[model samples]
Structure formats: structure tokens, C-alpha cells
Target: MNAEFVAVFVGSSIRFAAPLMLASTGELISERAGVLNMSVEGMMLSGAFLGAAGAWATGNAALGLAIGMLVVLPIALLQAFLSVTLRANQIVTGIGINILALGATTLAYRELFGERSSAVIPGLARWSPPGLGAIPVIGEPVFHQVWLVYLGLAILLATSLVMRRTALGVALHAVGAAPRSVDQSGLSVTRLRYGAVLFSGVMSGAAGCFISIGDIHTFTEGMTGGAGYLAIAAIIFGNWKIGRTVGACLLFGAASALQFQLPLIGVHVPTALLVMLPYLLALIAVAGLIGRQTAPLALTQPFRR
Candidate 1:
């Protein structure tokens, strides 16, 4: 690829990666808190729908984003309550939440929109950098992205800073690594996990917002498809750090972006095969268990009282 191609490639790569990165990092946070919130797919789909609906209703994309974020909180709290305070099986509860979200979003769409599966909402505007958008190699792509892309980057950076530098971060790690010990010190393991899961929920909501409002500018039934699951895979591939997860998401995103380019490049893979690239890569990655990034000791294991 030439310079323009390279810029477009990278720009598209980041745009595609942003949603997954947000969701993956959110999953990483939730999982790290010793809670297995597996409803990411459902949450994302729900977010996608609500975000689009919110925009359509309010005519403001940012308001739509807030609506999506609000939508996930109750679900996250319920999951945390069941799995953490009650000491339920984290996996089962998470999966249950997933089912609930899927059903709820679909039903809402049918009821409100009269069974139409998808529609484009009022999307956020995009802006290219002033005076730089015309640069031969870098114009029109990276410079012309929506605000959510920059927000994704900021979130990633902030998450990293918190992970490495804050006492709250240390406490979260403690809860994940040894909740019993955290509880021994009277630090409220329940609170930490609750906060972590809620944070994940908000981030996932933002991800959904990006998909419907920023990337696709529309919400389609089952549009998220399996991207939430893919986000989890990315977290594994990235070894649980925000930056690493972004990198992994970008890698997968590039593969996704390549789909449109394939025919142009004269590589006519089967359509199904083209679509399967990201998931296939995920499977291949998990097969080797490369580097074996370990989760916290208590991850996915509910803590009682």
C-alpha cells in the first residue's frame, strides 16, 4: 500500500478496532475484578439498539450515548448482585444476562419500529483536522474520524493509568487476586467488583454507541453479531492490558477492513470465509494459548459476603 493507502488502512483499522477495544477493555476490567460478566454480547447489542433509538428520539448522538450507558447499569448491577453478593456461578448469571438482553432488545425493536430490523439514526458528525486534511498521504481517513474514536483512545489511556498508578486500581487488583484477603482488610470486595462491572457496562455501552452512531450510523438487529464475543477474545489476545487489547483489536479490525479490499486486490475468497477471518484468527490464537496470560486467581469465581 502507498502512503494514502497506509493512512486509510490505519484509520479504518482504528475505527473498526475502537468498538472492540472498548468492549474488550471493559471485559478485562470486569473479569479482573473476579467477576465473569459474560453478557457482553447482549449488552453490546442492547447498547446498539438503545443508542440508535436514543439518537432517533432525541436527535442528539451524545444523548443517545448516555441513554445506552444508562441502559446497561441496571443489568450490570443485577448481575453483580446475583453473582457477587449471592455467590452464584458467575458464568451462568452472565450468560443469563446475555439471553435477557438479546430478547429484550429484539422485542423492543419489534414493538416500537413495527418489526423493521434496522435503520440509520442521526449519527455524530465527523471532522478532519484543519489544514492537515489535505495532506497527500494522511488526508480523508484518520483526520476525518468521529469524536468517539478519540474518546476510545482517551479511555484506553486513562484505564492504563488507573491500572498502573492508582490506589483504586491496586484495590481492584487485590480483589481479583485474593478477595478473601481484600475482605479481611475491610475494603469491601463487593463494592470493588460492583464498580468494576459497572465500569465495564459503561464502556460496553460506549462501544455500542460507537457501532450504531459512529461506525455504521445505523442499528441493525443482531448487528453486533458476535463482536462482543470477539472483544473477549481480544482481551485474551492482548494479555488484559488496555493498550495491548487495543492492539489486538486493531489487528482483528484490519482483517475486517480487508474484507472490502479483497475483491479489489483480486483475491476472491468465499464470502463466508472472508467474514470468518476475525473469529478464525481468534480460534487459532486460543489454540496455541500463546504466552498464557493468566487472569486473577478469583476471576469468575463469585465471592460470598
Candidate 2:
């Protein structure tokens, strides 16, 4: 392949992976804190709808992004209350939330934009690093992207540091590993879990906004297209480590990018298979085909104080 092709492929890969990185990073934290947040899909879809609507109504992509993230908080709160406070079945609650989000967004979109469904929504601005944008041949295509991509990277770095090097991180780890111990030591298990789930919601919302405004500037009925599940898969494939999870997201992104890239090279693969690659890989990872998988001991286990 030529340099142009390589640049396009790499850029597309990054674009596809950005949302996964954001969502999975948040999910990782929630899982680490003993809550399995399966409702990330719903949270992301809600964010996409609200973000697009907010931008379209106010004519400010930035404001729309903020609104999108904020709107998902109530949903996140519900998720936390169900799983952490009421001690409900985490998986069942998550599935219910996802169904609710899908139906609500579909109805809301039709009501708000019925005749103007195809109208052009405002999109987030693009930016590139000072030096990187100036590189030859591959510079613009590979480095220039929606500003959210850079912001997401920064957030990922900060998350890594906080999880690995902070007292708060230690507490989070302890809560996931042994909630009873954390409670005995004066830390509130309910509080930690609630915070983790909320954080996951916020991140998932941003991820959705990235798709609706940052990337496509449009909101389809289900724009996320199972990316939330892909994020969960990335977490599983990464074996719950930050570095590995990031790698898995990139790998999945590349797999997705190939669906388009292969056509350029005269390589004909089934479109359905390409679309299914990430989920299939995730299934393999979950099935222990890769190796022995070990999740947090307290994951999905409700704590009672």
C-alpha cells in the first residue's frame, strides 16, 4: 500500500477506536469498583441523541456536547441506585436501561426533527497538535482529527495515572476486590460504587457525543451501532488492564477500519463479517480462547452495609 493508503487507514482506525477508548476506560473503572455497568450502550445512545438535539437547537456544538454529557447523569444515577442501593440484578437492569434508551431516543428524534430529519447538524471542530499537523505526506490525515480525540487521549492518560498512582485508585481497587474490607476500614462501598457508575455514565455520554457531533454530526435512530458492547469487549479482551484495554480498542478499531480499507485494495470480504469482527473477537476473548480470564472478585456482587 502507498503512503496515502497507510495514512487513511491509520486515521480511520484512530477515529473508529476513539469512542471505544473513552467508553471502555470508564467501564474499566466501574468494573474495578465492583459494578458491572451493562447500560453503557443506553448511556451512549442517550448522549448521542441529546447532544445532536442540543447542538441543533442552540447552534453550538460545544454546548451540545456539555448538555449531552450532563443529560446522561440521571440515567447513570438510576443505574447506580438500582445496582448499588437496591442491589438489583446488574445484568437485568442494564438490559432494561438499554431498551429504554433506544425507544426513548427514537421517539424523541421523530418528534423533534420529523420533516427535517436530514438537516445538517453542527459538528465539533477539528484540531491537530502544533508540530504533528505540519508533518509531510501523512501529517494532516493521520494527526488531524476531531478535538475530542485529543481530549479523550488526555483523559485516558489521566485515568491511567489516577488508577495506578493515587489513594483514590487504591480505595477503588480495594472496593472491587473486597468491599467488606473497604467498609470495615471506613470507606463507603455504596459511595465508591455510585461514583464509579456515574463516572462510567459521563464517559459513555462523551463517547456518544463524539459520534453524533465530533465525528458524524448526525444522529440516526441507533447511531452507536453496538459500540458500547464493543467497549465492554475491549475491556474483557484487555484483561482489565488499562494498557491492554487500550490496545484491544485499537485492534477492534483497525478491524472496523478494514471494512472500508479493504475495498480500496481490491480485497473483497463479506461486509457482514467485517462488521461482526470486533464482537466475534470479543466473544473469543470471553470464551477463554485467548487465555485464562480473571475478572474482579467482587464484580457484579452487591454490597450491603
Candidate 3:
């Protein structure tokens, strides 16, 4: 590949992978807590729309992020309640949440911004750090990302540290793998699950915000498309680990970047085929699900008292 192509590829991967890393990592946390969230797609789209709209209205990226987080937090809380406290069917409730968020956001958008032939939405500005761009090869595209891209790397590292080496990590693990045993030990399983769900929501909101502020900078119908679903898939592929999830994100990123550049690469592939790579890979990966890995013992089971 040409030097410029490599730079663009890496840059696009970083941009595409950043959101996946963030969202997938969030899903990892929730799944580790034994609560599967089906609403990530809806949450992402809603967050993106709200974040973009907020930025447009106030012209402040930070405020838009706050709004996006706020939009998804409640949904996370509900998941915690239904799955952790109420002991509802995790899969069904999760899917329900996705539907609710999708409908709610779409309707809200229509009410707030009347439907027209085309809608104009402004998003956050990109920031390329100085000096870093001067590095050979990977500097330009990699370093010239938004502030959130940098923050995402930090968050991923910190999360890994917490999961790998920390007291809270152990407690969270206990709550997921064996809520009854944890409860007998005098810990509140519901509370821990609630915290995990909320944190996941916050991170997902951040992911959605990145899509609005980083890539499109404008809200469209189904702005997040299927990113939330992809996040869930990434978590499954990563087997609930922060580091592995990063790999999954990168894989999907490459697929996504390829879809957009197949023509430039002098290929005459079918458009539909190119667009399906990421999802197809996800199907293959998930289908190859190997030996039974241990999930949170209390997974999808509500904890009472």
C-alpha cells in the first residue's frame, strides 16, 4: 500500500475503532456482571442524535456529551432494575429496551426538529495534537484525532487495571459469578449490578457522542445504524476482557474501513458484499463459540434482598 493510503487506513481505523472499543468495553463490563444489555444499538442512536442536536443548539461539544450520557443513563438503570432486582428475562428485557429507546428517540427527534428533505446537524470539531503528528508513519492520522479518542485509550487501560487488579473488581466478579454466595457474604448483589449497568450506559453514551462529534458531525435517521449490536458482538468475541475487546474492535474497524475504500483499492466487488464483511465476520466468530466458558452464575437472575 502507498504511504498515504496506510496513513488514511490507520486514521480511519482509529476513528472507527475508538467507538467500538468504548462501547464493546462497556458491554464487557455489563456482561461480566451477568446482565446482557440488548439495547446498546438504540442507546447509541439516541445518544448520537441527542449529542449532535445539543452541540448544534449550544455549539459546545462538552455539553452535548453530557446530554448524550444523560439520555442513555436511565436506560441502563432500567436494565439493572429488570435484570438485577426484578429478575426479568435478560434477553427479552434487553431487546425491549432497544425498541423503546429507538422509538422514543426517533419520535423525540421528529417533535423537536420537524422532518424535511434534509436536516442540517453540526457536531464537535476535530483536534490534532502538535508534535505527535511529526512522528514517522503513524503520527499524522493517529495523533490527529479528537480529545475523546485519547480519553478512550486511557479509559480502556484503566478499566483493564480495575478488572485485572482491584478490590472492586473482585466484588463485581463475585456478584456476577455467584450472587447468592456474595449475598451470603453480606454484599449487595443488586447494588453492584446496578453500578455496572450504569457505568456501561455512560460508556455507551460516550461512544454515541464520539460518532456524532467525531465522524458524522451530523445526526441522521438511525445515526448509530448497528454500532450497538456490533459492540455486543465485540464483547462476545473478546470473551469479556478489556484487552481482547480492543482486538475485536480493531478487527471490526478494519472491516469497516475496507468497506469504504474497496473501490479506491481498484476492486470491483459488489457493494452489498463489501458492506457485509463486519457483520459476516461477527456471525462466523459467534458461531465458532467454543467450549463452555463460565459466565456470571447469577447472570440474568435477579437478586432479592
Q: What's the number of clashes in each of the models?
A: 0, 0, 0
Candidate 3 lDDT over residue span 182-262, tens digit each: 889887777778898888888888899899766777666677778888888887677666777788888889888887766
Model 3 collision count: 0
Best-to-worst TM-score order: 2, 1, 3
Number of the top lDDT candidate: 2
Predictions: Cα RMSD each = 1.7, 1.0, 1.9
* Candidate rank order under lDDT: 2, 1, 3
What are the lDDT scores of the predictions, listed in order? 0.82, 0.94, 0.79
Between candidates 1 and 3, the one scoring higher on lDDT is: 1
**Which portions of model 1 miss their true places by more than 4 Å?**
129-134
TM-score of 3: 0.93
Clashing pairs in 1: none
Candidate 1 residue lDDT tens string, 1-305: 46766687778887888889888878888888888778888788888888889998998998998898788788778888887788888778877888888888888888877686556588877876687667777778767888877777778788888988999889888899999999999899888999988888888888888898877887777778888888988877877667777778989999888877667657788888868999997886666566777767898877765
Residues 84-138 of candidate 2 have per-residue lDDT tens digits of: 9999999999989999999999999999988348867899999989999889988
